[model samples]
Target: MKTNGKKTGSGRIAYRKRDRVAYLYLLPWLIGLVMLQFFPFFSSLYYSFTDYKVTGGMNWIGLDNYIRLFTKDADFHNSLKVTVLYTLYTVPLKLTMALAIAMFLNRDIKGINLIRTLYYIPSLFGGSVAIAVLWKLMFLDNGVINAMLTALHLPNIQFWGDHRYALKTICSLEIWQFGSSMVMFLAALKNVPKELYEAADIDGSGKIAKFIHVTLPQISPIIFFTLIMQTIQALQNFTSAFVITNGGPLKSTYVLGMMLYKEGFAYFNMGYASSISWVIFAMIVVVTLLLFRSSSAWVFYEDEEK
Candidate 1:
């Protein structure tokens, strides 16, 4: 019995030794994440507290940035409001459209390989500088959109000329780039247990019922992930706003990102830009946390305790 106990202890030690070796293999990634990701995160926190201008040294400014933003800066509030509006509109529309389209494509169809490539093409060009420039031309007052309207006997539409509808064109552009999220939803959909869907169908459930009862629950985690990502992407959007209206008509589409760019790079006011960036970061953090909090009611897992 003593010898058997000795053997058991040796086996336990060997297992721990194997785990230590496995973790050692992950050491490089751990170090890189801490140095590159974690360090920069805390550094941004420090930068937010100081008045760091591109032309001048980072001066210690305690609460001045936040104070000015709330009390004196109208543009800051306007930008924040615009960003929130854009995030709320873009995230849901984009992800829902992506999932709907992905569900259609999830079936085994003829030329599905070609179809996937075609769908994926937009996401590849979505963030490119050239594509943004092209989008600007497409949305110009007398551009193709207006040409089509005129052909149908409708008055010529002004995409950027009108303040109210100007942001809609930008939102449309953001929604058009739904391919990335669609692909993710597609993968998650494929992994959903076919048995659950079969069981639903056997009960005479229709397509919509099957989707609600079986598909959505299984892929809810991916939907949540894409929702958070798309929200962040839309909130921090700069290129579309920059290229399309140049925050124009009258700063109508001046999102927080565009404001950050104008303040930091154009005016060489790094201190103010850093403040704006910090505000954006805080807003994103808060909204994301709220989503997480809400997810407790909706987001499910195979393991309930998880």
Candidate 2:
């Protein structure tokens, strides 16, 4: 018994040494998380309460910034409203297009892989500065689209110049990048059991019936996930608004992200910017929570059925 006790003690010491080595190996990641992620995250939260200018030092301001944003700042109100509208316009339309294309591509046809690759190519560069620039150029007064319109004897459209069309143009750019969502939808569609469709057919269900009763229930979880993700992405959209319209035509495209950028970098209102960032963060959290709350009603799981 004495010998066994000694052996156990020695084993415990060896384990401690191994754990120390493992901790040493994790040092870099720990340091990075502290300095790069956590520190910045908390610091922004703190800064949001202060009047911290980029050039001028931080000064404590309580809830003045938030109060101003809610009441006094019409620009903030407009930006928030525009952002919400943009999110509403983009997410559903984009997801619908994605699901449609995914359904079309979900086949055992030849060269389908090549076709998918071609379709996915747009999403790869859709959010890029170059693509935004190209979109801008293509929508200009004397651009390719207008040229085509002229050939058809139609009057030129002011896509970027007109406030009514500017936001829609940006929404179209976002919708055009439906390839990623389509791929996800395609994967989800493939995973749905063929047995379900066969059972539906045995019940004399038509294509539409099978789709509604069979396919949608099976793919509901993926749809829910995509909806949440796409909503978040649409809320944070900046590159298209900045590079294409620059929130132009009477600030029609002035989204929350562009507002944040202007507040932070352009105007050097670091504290105000941090507050805006937190507001955006809060909005995302609330939206995500609402989705999760609503998900129980719609999102289906195979395990739940089991």
Error of 1 at 190 (Å): 2.1
For each candidate, what TM-score against the reference?
0.86, 0.91
lDDT (10s digit) by residue, model 1, range 1-306: 332323366787976666678678998999999999899777766776788877778878888887888899998888888888888788888888999999999998999878877888888876678887887788788888788888999988678888887787888888888888988988998899888888887899998899887888888898888888777778799988997788886777999999999988999777677778888888879989998999977787889847
For candidate 2, report its TM-score: 0.91
Instruction: Please give, for residues 90-176, the per-residue lDDT of candidate 2 as tens digits.
Output: 999999999998998898989987888888888999689999999999999889999999999999999999998999989988899
lDDT of each: 0.84, 0.91
The weakest ten consecutive residues by lDDT in model 1 span: 1-10
Checking candidate 2 for backbone clashes, the offending pairs are none
Error of 2 at 214 (Å): 1.3
The whole-model C-alpha lDDT of candidate 1 against the native structure comes to 0.84
Stretches > 4 Å off in candidate 1: 1-39
